[model samples]
Target: IFFVSIKLTVPLAYFYILLILVRELCEKFPGSLYIPIQTYLPYLASVVSTMQKSSTFVEVWAIIEALFYICLRLHIQWLQYKDPLEASLSSAPMLELWERRQLWERIMEIETDDPVSFVTGWFFDQDLQHITRYDVLDFVAWSMFEGRNQEHLTGDELGQLHDFVDELEWKISEHLNRSDSLIPEKNTDKNEVGDNRKDNQETPITSEFTQEKNDLDLSDGISSPRRDQGDRPRNQFRFPENVDDDSPDFFTNLYENYHNWYEQTKDRLENSDFHPVQGIRNYMAEKRQQIVEKEKNAMATASNLAENAYNRLVSPGSNMDKQLMALSHATQSQLMDAWNSMVEMKERLETAKFVSSKRKVLQQQLRGYRHLLDSARAMSSAIPSNQMADLMRKITQCNEAIERVEWSARDAFVKATGYARKNILQRTEPQRYAKYSHDPLLGISTYPLMFHLLILGVTDGGLRVILRRRGFERRTMGPIAYYFHPGSSDHTEDENEELNDEDREMTPIVFCHGIGIGLLFYLPLIDEMLRLGRPIFLPEIPYVTGFRPWQSP
Candidate 1:
């Protein structure tokens, strides 16, 4: 009977979806559509359907209603796919629990499934990857999807990603406008190109290296030119010496291999239109620029110290010069060592595709590429003069769309992407970190950045690392806060507990959140803490979100 009536039921199902959509619209904006008071026909239809007996008129109208819904749905689906940018994602499907958990976990850096979600298998495909929405999608569907989300972005999550990308582009553009500080002799415009071209020319690195060779040669010609090794500072900061002569760190070795991998994938670019490779390349360019700035900052700090030492060295105003002179020598010698080490370190960094080979990483990265990369590469492939203009328009459109996102939308966006999570459980393979548990993922310098701020941590990814380091299992936390808290200390079954505590502790941490989080904001956090064997008590903050005005007094 079910198979025989497939056509009948399928049309009804389609109609039901549209009916809900229309009902939502009507309820949301009753006056905007200016429908007559009789616009309540759908409700009457629903009520009549519930009646014990229906008239012939009702039966006839039901079939008509189903057809009308089918047409509306077809029109909507057609419109969605007509936009090339939108069409790619049309087949991406809805989020699945596992994929959504993974994506949300990867982004937020934590594992909590407060509100379970599912990411469609289509969207998960690396072969048919969509980068645009992946790159910028943090929008909560009902903030559009949920009743909550503050709707802090451009009306939704999609808008938030656009806004974030625009801000970053503007910053990148600004950086390019300024003079390149890395190679002081050449302007930034030439310097970046020069650095990249080194592989092509097979030239020896650095004009500085050439100059140093000349100075060495000249000094040798004069004879008796051996500088004092005694002058070298050993006790203080020392750069890694003999890097080429010595073994490389794991990061360096891995990156070197990755570069070779990139070369291997060069053909893939030609075959697949080279869009994804181009996205990775753009990301690498941005990262490379950042690396340059970091190097410059390090050098400038060393040079400033050197200058200060020179002032103290000849002055000899007091006994302090002894320490100051030592300090200066240490700083200068360390600087030289650093330059040498970096030259060695440079050998390890390869422009290789990493996240590419890994499926999970690929999906996440592809999401970042989708819409923007398609436009960018298309623009880049275009001929020069007109290319710049087209690129500018695309960029401007992206920027305008981003700037339009409101704070409420931002809040909603974060909620959608798992940024606004409080407590929950996520099933993931155990993360391997540290030689031993309890080693913090963040160094003290980096840790404070994740602390209380006007904004939230971009995602729970970092928080998750912290949780895993603390020795709590995410999904394995048993029924009780301590499944066996009062058990004997020697129980091998209880590896999660920190047996070393003085036993007077209540919890490892306590957080005070802005109000109106409505217990939901903490679902993720609560799950994380419990997994880590830590209990958290969340108190309310005054003059904050979600609190009543009368409660403030």
Candidate 2:
């Protein structure tokens, strides 16, 4: 019945609009009539009836609607694609859980209906393949535990269920790995471009690196390098002879130990021969020892009294000179090591775009290393000795190179994550992508003209007024916080009479906006008054309101 009505109504509607256009054209120029649509009306009617009976018109309407939506989607994509920065910034990472609520609900429903089918079919579905692999593992684990509760299930059935779950977990991992590998390599290129563009703009880093003591002369603010030269009263600092050669190499050892421990722990967990608590405690202790030793060695390398004393004595210079040079060299070597560490960390961060929090940590670490590098350079320049100072400057240069690498790594991570998120959303839920991509364009295009009255007022010299009741400390002020504009809504008669009076009769309104926000805070109210052609008065307050620097009380 629905199809029959659609078939009948659509053709008649199209014909009705065509006849109206034809009538208007004929009336405007009687002699210009060409096709003579009136003569073919009966034939058109017969064709329409035939199409209705066969329901062929339904397909025609469908095709037309498809074309219309296609054009709409294209326009939306063009608007979003034209502004790439906006698109990247607006990429949603948790879109699957939030905006794709319907899809999640459907998955849960399917899982409830047949847990086994859900577990097996989930990995096969491409749209859902990018979802967190652990989430799938959890679901499979739950399904297995529930199956174990069924009294009707035999030992063979339970064993098969465990086997199926293991296979499903393996497949899910494979799918996630494939998805991660598919993340485009453009992130690295973007990082390079960002580094190059920010080279000149990285003044903060360069200045920080070359920063010096400013207390040499307060009156002239002139830097006196020699004034602080004799300030080093002791030769207490020293550098290890092989400071530059030592590489810590902690991550490699950590990874190896972790992998071996993980495999052994997995076997132990599955065997369940020993008590669970004691076995878990033993596994944890082994892991803790691995990490604790690595950290202890790293800290010892940073400061060792015996090693520093040996390096200083071997130099055989004036005690102070030898100590200064050794200290400079040690600082330089530490800066270089930090630089190398940051580069490696950034690369790892870029390659692993699955966790956003990891990227944030990498960024923070990069910033800290960069700051240390700059401080080394600044402190080097402040040293009076040329040789020691030169070493410090070299350290600064090494840090700058590391900074570039760090920036690239961060850029790569951000870009990769954004790319992955977009692809995942686009594949799993196209409507969500279309909505997110096009909604901004729609808002920009339609916002100003959404209400035709605003458009009409622009040319008509009419102002739009808005009346709002404001709350302050639980008390309400009605009509006091009002927007007055041309053609705006009417207010009380008393207010209108005063507004019309040649001589101002009403008391001037004094707006007391709370907080450090000064006159600029009341700009909206000021604008309304300007529109109404009224005078504005601004009173100066000592430290609270007008012309006052912001200060915390």
Candidate 3:
């Protein structure tokens, strides 16, 4: 009995001491329990039953040893089941609206000399939305023209530009055709209504027609032709009411003209005899002369205004203060008129087709108005201090507005020429795995190898089983495998009933292991965390697991 007791009691006492030590440590840490006390209840009951039945020390020790091995086996099974790396693959999340906007902003910020190649490479094998694709196409198209001379471009570069423009035009044409197809359906419905109420709606129809005509005249800056009532068609189709009557037809004509111009430019590029550069230089010289003449006229007007102000100031029986005020008011009025003209020019530029000649003319007119405003500003400096301050403030505001208009005009032109429809029709499969070279076991520690061979497998298997029992589901997203538990829903009813307000409000924890022994090493910590009743996400990083150096996802 003494020999048997020594053999059984020593191991049993050691196990009890270890358990006590663990309990004490858990108490000290305040919420960390490696294994809950309930886990030992079966062992405790068996020991009590053996002692009560007067069982021999050898039998008692055999029973204790068997129970210990059984517990170890259960742990190994749990580890295998709960392993995140073993999870199945899931689909990647779609990009949100704000994320796409941010992506576009970042793409626009990228500056490169070869924008076409850069854009194509960036978008290759990637799915993009229609508007986003168009925005990119427009940016590339405008970039080709920006600060680039047609004569200087190589054959390949010119061809590329031409091809991109053709694509852009095709996209625009497709959109217009789609819009046209929808138009007749809407018009037919309107025609049916008009036919049914012909007599009763005549007065209203006539009034609506007159209103539409007035609107077209005001917006298009062209008067509608007068037609006799007898000449009107019985089934006249009306377009959908829009701010710009030009709409699809105007854009279609503009693109067509641009295409012709592009063909002519391409021909010029190919021909050595025709010097388009020389013609462009001559045109620029003529514009410069016109600008000089306009500047002279502005100077003359300023001189005349000064002379009139001087005459008023020196004339007998004339109030000096009143004349100065009048001069200031006149200068302010001229500045206001110049600002209004700039605003009108800006509006025209925005609405006008992206024709080079029309853009240059409007830009020239804008410069002339700006010069006039500057001249008016210079004249106003001689006025009273208070009036000068007001004038300067107004001038600043006018300058800012003009700058914004110029930016808007540039953006509009780019959008008109550069944009194209979506190029990607279908998305390709996402990359799932990465290739890595194998490393030899020259410097690797022998202890880790031994531990993994002898101990790690069983522990990992047990951890997996434990996790599965706790209702954690495994899935793979892209290259990473992960385990997820839905917290409250996964928990038993008793556990949910036991949860406090704080536990209910606790945010989900994302637990990722470092470059060590993988997640199996963190089982104790994870087990403690599970008690909080919060959802957990565990993504497996294979490269850092130390088990496999070659195979990685």
Candidate 4:
């Protein structure tokens, strides 16, 4: 997600620079470039260009044509940086803008195969270094040529917008399609449906419906995909507790038969310190945590610097140059802070490098830890597995989040997608994050849409569309991380203490109420659904305000 956004921003930022130049130019010219249509038309009429004896009216017509050409060119170029609203647009601008908007929207909707991380493409063979930034640059250059002295967006910003959108989309989709991917597909039931319309294609599902595209129709009515239904194929999707072959357990058991392989793969070294699956996880987790904390601290510090810069910029009577200078200064400060942190961490690690002579002892300890984690990561519940009905219920809850962002911030969202940022204001507000009573059953509701959005790493139009229908604005917005409290080997969480009935089926529970209404208002009901049995991670929430003032780029 980060790389994608960076890739996108480079061009947008460049274009923004161009826009800044245009704005400065127009400000200098005043009536010459930015006059009203009335004033504009009269000026055009004053120019004389006719070869056939220049009469006042003839000369006026010639001047008007010249000015009209100029204005038309400007309008076309300005529209080139089309907004995300293109998908919903009823009309389009001239060639440059229209084509560019279409291209961007297509990029925005690009979907990747799941289980592949959003960062995957960016990292493949260090794809970032090899990535040509030209796709965005070309479109941007075209937009700036004749259009409004500026585009609705600068190219760099538009690129960043694309990355931002992509990342959010990836995170949201990931959250929805969790290993326990049941939510989004439940209502959109054609998942199992094969394309019956495709000739010679074997349809795996059994019922009236056919193909994934049949989603909208099936929810309205119960239309099974497979018509030639005999004995329904038993679910290939193996449950962990009630283990199925397709389940990880299926391979795990096979891998276990090769017990030594599970303990120590040949690739790691015959007597490598790296223990099998479990030990690596622990090592990775600890290492990852260290990285995360450093990152968080850096971001916090950078944010502080940005806030200070913004404060200075917005002081009344500050000139445009002052604001630009502040933006430059703030950006530099943040970058320097991040670089210093990274360097410090790198040096410390380098200096305290592990002693190789102790490798043998470390290997032994690693083996032990690895085995423990392998057992831990895979431990299924000893208790009876959750009922199918319960799982289905949670799936339904997650489905709701898939469409919530569409209508609420309709314009803001659409505009943001195309780089229409006016200034930074939070989408949600800062307040104490309200802690909710933990209902293991409410795991579905608490799964955290904002987290999911951030995790999947992008927001599409869906959330806003749903939000508008509900008529709620983003009262308070901010990032939130809901901790999923640890459970036993299986994925279940504890029931809310107040609501006794120990035997009552409880799924893994996560609590999220914090800072603003973004998480509090939108998430609760959804989290209630996704809880499974034990082996849960305890819930922890960390967030910053929805927005903080930063120098505008």
**Model 4 lDDT tens row, 1-553:** 8545534443444443444444455556657764542365544323211122334564344344445444544544444443322211212232333454455445434543441333324234332222222322222333322121112233433453344333333333333223323323333346342322222232222111122222222122222222123322221211012111111122222222344442345466546655443465577579879989998988887988876886886765568768888898998799677666656544433322322213324345545544443343244532112222232223333222212322223333333345444542223211111112111112111111223345333322344444334332332223322323333333334444433465244544444445542343444453343333332322222322232101000
Which of 2 and 4 is the better model by lDDT? 2
Quick one: ranking by TM-score, best first?
3, 2, 1, 4
Q: What RMSD does each model have against the real structure? A: 35.8, 34.4, 29.1, 34.3
> Where does model 1 exceed 4 Å of error?
1-53, 82-318, 328-337, 344-349, 352-553
lDDT of 1 by residue, 95-140 (tens): 3334433453353322122111121122243211122222222222
How many clashing pairs per prediction, in order? 50, 3, 21, 95
TM-score of each: 0.16, 0.18, 0.20, 0.15
**lDDT (Cα, 0-100) at 235 in candidate 1:** 14
Q: RMSD to the native, candidate 2?
A: 34.4
What are the runs in model 2 whose C-alpha is more than 4 Å off? 1-8, 34-114, 121-132, 135-553
Error of 4 at 514 (Å): 50
Q: Worst 10-residue stretch by lDDT in candidate 4?
A: 238-247
lDDT of 1 at 545: 37
At residue 482, candidate 4 shows an lDDT of: 32
Residue by residue across 375-427, what tens digits does model 3's lDDT show?
54346333343343343334444444544444444445456445433431222
User: How far is 218's C-alpha from truth in model 4 (Å)?
Assistant: 12
